[model samples]
Target: MYYADAAADNSVTAYDLSSGSRTVLCNMHVQELTLYQEKLYFTCTDGEKRTIYRMNLDGSDLESLASCEDLWYMTIYKDVIYYVNYENDQYAILSMKLDGTESRILRKYNASDLCIAEDKIFFAERDTRYLYSMNLDGSDVQQLNSTYSRCINYMNGQLYYYGSEENGRNVYSCDLNGNVTGKYTSGAKFLMLMEEELYYYDWDDVLHILPLNKKSEEENTSHGTNIVSYKQEDVLKPVRSYLASNWAGYTLDEGNITKQGNTWIILLSESGGSRQYQLIIDLTTGKITILCTTEDILPVSVYLYDTAPSVSPSAAQLSEEELNSIADTWYEQNYGPGGAWCFEYHDYDGNGTYEAFAVCGPVMGDGYDIDPYNILEAILYISSTGEITVIEKDVRDTDFCVENEIEKEYYIEYDGKGYYVPHFRSGGILWQPMYGVKDNKPYDTGISGHISLDNDGDLLYTPNSGIFMCPECNNHVEHKHILAYDETSGELKSAVKYPSGEIVN
Candidate 1:
């Protein structure tokens, strides 16, 4: 198998699992890796410029395809190369033919984890840190879910990606429209699915394999509460020792240990029970990484609620004008002059120190949709000492829409509780992707399930446009028939009617 090692200077390497041998194909800063026909396509740093290169499997006939100042990721579909260009401090999703012809920009936004499947393009927008799907031509953009997702992989009619939640980064199975169906093992980075097994890297950068031939019912038993083998102890000892020495009062929570083949997922909490952390350990290397940390208790029931809790404003040391001045100065320094920006202060987590949402644009407007040509948004955290931490940037928030009253809710869960995260929106007219906050960092929490109808009573599904049902084979078809999405199967069916007017799925 051929893979790009992002940690190893993005070196493209080929591994022989059966023979336990390895060979380095390209020794450069290879960023993106994909295979088309018999050619290996990848992007690498090439002396004063980043360029895309293609070569044979044996590393022969190397040729440069495209060059730019900076490129993030790329994917190929139907003999075309789709990549993100971060030149001139702007992210432009562009596509070109195999011979590097017909190059054009598809969208002006920051994108990563780009993958094309089922004739649709899936990507993770860095600004909001959410998964989104769009047409192959980069139109009909739709947010799939709220999870901060990357390392997207598609298999068996389902899309799987690494979801960054309050708990940890785990692999989640969702439909094309982003309705989460099931969660697999935890703590994953790059995921590569094979015919009989799934190979992925753990948080420790160690490689692990999961059997794909296992039955669905056996999945839980395979990874849940199994007795710790002697091999598992070796992995835990290092993590336990690391925590005991480095974390002082923090101790490993043995009860939460989950076995995912060669990897182990463990939890730890402070002696005073004030903070808890989730970690994954590599069995072979005995390496460990803290996936997430929370105060008091884990947010177990956060997903049950939909509405955001209200926050009562408190007296602030900095006036509104002072906050605006700070935000304006930040905008000018980061994006330069001749740009319009706006700011709003709110204690999102009900903390005494208020954070500001600064939305900037190239046009002289105050709202998020000021310029269709440029995207600018930032969530700035203001500490009690007047320190600023830009938690998120390049986000297009809908809450700041000036034309319409858009009520979008963002949330963060802590200590078994959920708090609504704040964001601006422009009603139902513009993109209203939700955002979630955890550990003072904001992430995109994508929209799901809801379906809207057009003025002609035609059902409009966001993720899949061809999804539909028939009240009767050829009988009266109307928009009243609500479409029910099956996340597990990634199929859309009518909630009220069947394919032939029968009351069956």
Candidate 2:
């Protein structure tokens, strides 16, 4: 598991579950440690500026992406960076290309707890604290719920958030359209789901667990899985003995302990020295294993993938008909009949050869609504030798639309290469997939890219003047509001278009 240690030297560390080994990737004040495409993206300080940096998983190639004074809640959605920026005590959500170029504000609201899923951005307005969602372009904004909510998260087709109700704080569930589904575990916050169970911290900061499959929140589960806490003696006895025998000269200071399944991971440091060591203890058998001594094992540099797959410059090309046949044959051989399938081809990796985006599942009935059928979508990588492979599979139809809609591309420079990344439209929702080639195989990186589109289905970019005027309203009495940024505060402001076709703030 990869975690940021804010309290200890402000470092980012990775712990191996099986070996109980720890590797401190970087020793810097870090926040939002997101690992994408074998690279680690995090927010840290560059002097007084809050900056986002990208580095290898092993702490190499540390490059700064962007820096600002009032930036927080940095997250990557489909390779596009979404973050909250505050200026003049006003909050505005902005997005930027992964390379830190093409920065634009999507919307201006006092927002917090920003999350993105299913081609929509979810957030909580700071003043009302209500849940709201909007299209990737910041248009068609909709309120998801009225109750004050925070800690918003998207999971498994539902939005889970901490809702403040009249009675008490409860973890609530709602659909993407703002309809309430269920409420579970009252008086709890920081909701998280793992292994088909819900884990939360209560008012007293005590951790609790509830099985998701249980009929109600009242159902009970085994204490071993629910509240897995160990007594101090269970940890200190073995730790004290190991420390005294190994580092008798140093005095014990403090230790940070975390648990995973049946094992306990403890990091112990000295009082006045820089010595630090890790202890992995099996709670089941009470056997303690020393992971490393400060002087013993430092992390070795390792890349996420030793070799990334590249397209052959002279690869054989396929006609559209030939590509379809290959995808159909693979689908039949794997799924074995009954389901229908189709393919959309694009050069996802910016390679000369076009990769296939395949969608296969139970045939859909007329007129929308896919919840009735099991859908599976995949990205197919075909070699020059006509060998077919499924690079990424089981993508939900709701994500990358499976419909026959017009395709658009967002052109941006990445890794010094210009790519017209394909964006697909389904049911009026548009999304793009982030692709990575690892070990000579291509796969969806699970990072999505969002692009703003005008009503005419063209890519919408920030105007050169940083001001927007409604193109449709000309000499009309209806007042149309357009977005503009304040010159002094850099905050998003609204301008009204008048009947005379003149716009004024």
Candidate 3:
């Protein structure tokens, strides 16, 4: 069993129920627990910091993920972890990949106990108690109902929730469209909705299992757990034919299609080591577009099987001269003729080989461009073995380009081995390297590019103050104390302000 004993100790512990042994995986105070594919991800607090951290099953190799003020109510589905976080001062629904990439605000409202089903995210608001859902990519959100439900769970194909209706609190079942199907039972001090049984304990602490239908307990054990095998169903031959006819010579995995507005997004990949494809199709126009196919593998002292040469081994490793030759060629191609470029020299992956980095573009072109021509871009890491891994993203995003300036505004933090080498903590950039505190100065993130310290000079993780046009209010919103980073301790720290124009430790 994996859980957090926040009352006893602010720690997440994994227990071997059979052996009756437990190990504390982390020291942070957890609000939730999730175990997926031998990895544990949870939201926790260290002082004022509200952040997410991921670790291996054996309680080793822990890494910090995304952080925000008022970060709470988190859950994961597929590769994305959804949570309620502050976006422009308003607590809103947001999501990021397990590695803390692709962070986006799904909707500008506080939601809790999120459950994903039928290709959509479902949650309820705490204030008004309205149930809502949206597409996986934070699009096409809709209010399902106004039922004041909590501890919401989805089983089979229906939604089960606890709420009050005429005579008091009860467990009610609702369809995907949010219509009441049936009331299961009442009195839920604790509720667990499984595939075969609904278990709950009352104020007396007596656990009761209410069987929904006839099923063996063995089958019930396998239900609603992580790592379900993707049982391949028969696909329409025409759909397979369309894929084979279009991609031609590439074997496609099972295609899952979901609609956002009028565009249908089909997410699958070629059976290659480079997990690099986000394919999309439009049902209304029958148009197909290859949206994103950027390279993903980091060439280092480590080379994946197919990308490696069987004979020469690392013998044919490109010399710095040869790598510079390739970098020069790419630079001239991107900037057009006689553009002198110098790169930061380091093994960004820390794999004993230098990656010739350059801020070159037209690398990823956005389809939803403002002018469909070109956009300012960022640096690309050229490996010693001639593979280029994108430092920021593997694909083009207009909105991301607007917010993050990859070439300059962002800084790199390594895994504590090398000075300039970058590290990817959980496959995303290790640290969004904070503006560190300068020598005896009030550091403003936007101005000095250094983090501000409290009077104690302890590291802090806070969002730099800025303004962005709010989609909800149509007015600019001020970004508040985001999340702070403690570089010395390599921990996520929250900022506490004092009346004397100071921050706290």
Candidate 4:
């Protein structure tokens, strides 16, 4: 049997059950682990990237299986190691041979907690709130049932799982065909099977054991599982100075966790009155290093946020200037002024062959009515040669009028030839109506209400209000209280409102 020790150093320890001898199989500060074929597999951090590694049962001949910055967990079958790679906010299940060959992605899901049985794999998906199964190669992937389950154990052609229900925690038993038998136990927190008895750690930290026989009464099978005893004093240790320092009034944020070299770094923020400071902790040595301090003079809010530092590639790394130069040349020739030069390149094209989009503006001329302030115009350029073309003029409107009436209008001249115009829509007045609303509007509803809308142009605001919209449908919506209409169909398809001081659609 194989077990992972995630609580300490994230290592996998294997034992020879026949001889009662054990060895540390694989050790690393990885988040997930598993074993197969007298070999240990786990995830590890190499600088800023997370990757997978495999080693023999005796912890020798370690080798890398896959290189992904987000790989997690592992389950080995006959000759394959199946794992998950989370990147771009998506999770993909992948498998590779023992020698790191023939890698294939089994399936993709927003998932957590995974296990394998026979030729099938099981996973818990939070979005669907269901335990799903799929063939080892990704075919036949489907949700087994509507049951919310976790901590799956597959043995003897039976699947044992646990989950929380309305009343309390419950253990369930099912077969390979997704058929539920019955509840194994209720009100149990941590349940595991060893030998023939079910071992569990209770809510009170007391261990209990019960026989696996389904025929016995529930109360008759349970007994204490903890065989070792110790005095209360023996289990407690005096808190050291450095350990106690962690309890100081310091707040930790998500970006504070980072990996460097072979250690994890965590940044803690300490606040005092109107001042704030930051301390960095090295996980390997348990040492703290102060980074910076924000005094009362500097706005505390500006420096209060935590951000993970980017890891820079080695200076010897080759630069991609050649590729960039080629792309720039093509961009200027195909989209420059007097041509199609009104756009700027934003991203590579769908086929990954060329730039997808470019930024372009209009050309300008001298001040005149036809020239409308004679401002310079700009356009996006694209070609094999890098060159920019511009039309120069003045287009500023300091004293402006609206609809032949004296009204406030903001206009500015750019590059001694371009003009900027402003309008009012919602967010804020912009230079043009095509830019929609500005972003200076208040976002909260003073009455602390909720907003709802439907397709029939019906609107509802609520604290305890009922459904005010008949059958409302929204095509696109933004921060509550904003609405828009479809120009082509003349139909209202967007609306926003606040509910309970929160923005909702």
- TM-score ranking from best candidate downward: 1, 2, 3, 4
TM-score, cand. 3: 0.40
lDDT of each residue in 1-505, candidate 1, tens digit only: 8888666776888877678577888887676687889999988887878998999998888889899988876888899898888888677789999988889988787787787899998888877778888998889998888888877888877777776633346667788888887666656778877774556776667665554454672343223212122234434444455556567877777877786544567787778776767776543222355644664232221100011112101222455666666566656665665232444455544555545444454444565343433344555544322334454555555444422123323333332323233333344333433333344334443433334543543333342233444544357654244444456754345455434544344
lDDT by residue (tens digit), candidate 3, 1-505? 8888665575888777677677887777776778887898887775666889899977788888988776866778787888887545666888888898878877776777677878888888767667787888778878888887777778877787777433234667788888876554444545667765676653334344555553642222222110011111211233455556556645544445663522344555666544545544322122334544566232111101112123322333556676666555655543544211334444544556655554333433344234322222444455555533333323333432222223332334422322221111222212233222222111223322233333444333332233433342253332223134458865444544444535444
Regions of candidate 2 where Cα sits further than 4 Å from its true position: 165-167, 213-505
Q: What is the per-residue lDDT of model 4 for residues 317-384, given as tens digits with 9 covering 90 to 100? A: 11234224433453344334321222223212122222211222223333322422211222222211
**Model 1 regions lying over 4 Å from their true place:** 1-29, 217-505
Q: How accurate is candidate 2 locally (lDDT)?
A: 0.60
Q: Which stretches in model 4 have alpha-carbon errors above 4 Å?
A: 1-8, 11-27, 30-33, 165-167, 187-210, 213-505
> Whose TM-score is higher: candidate 1's or candidate 3's?
1
What TM-score fits each model? 0.45, 0.44, 0.40, 0.39
Error of 3 at 51 (Å): 0.7
Best by TM-score: 1
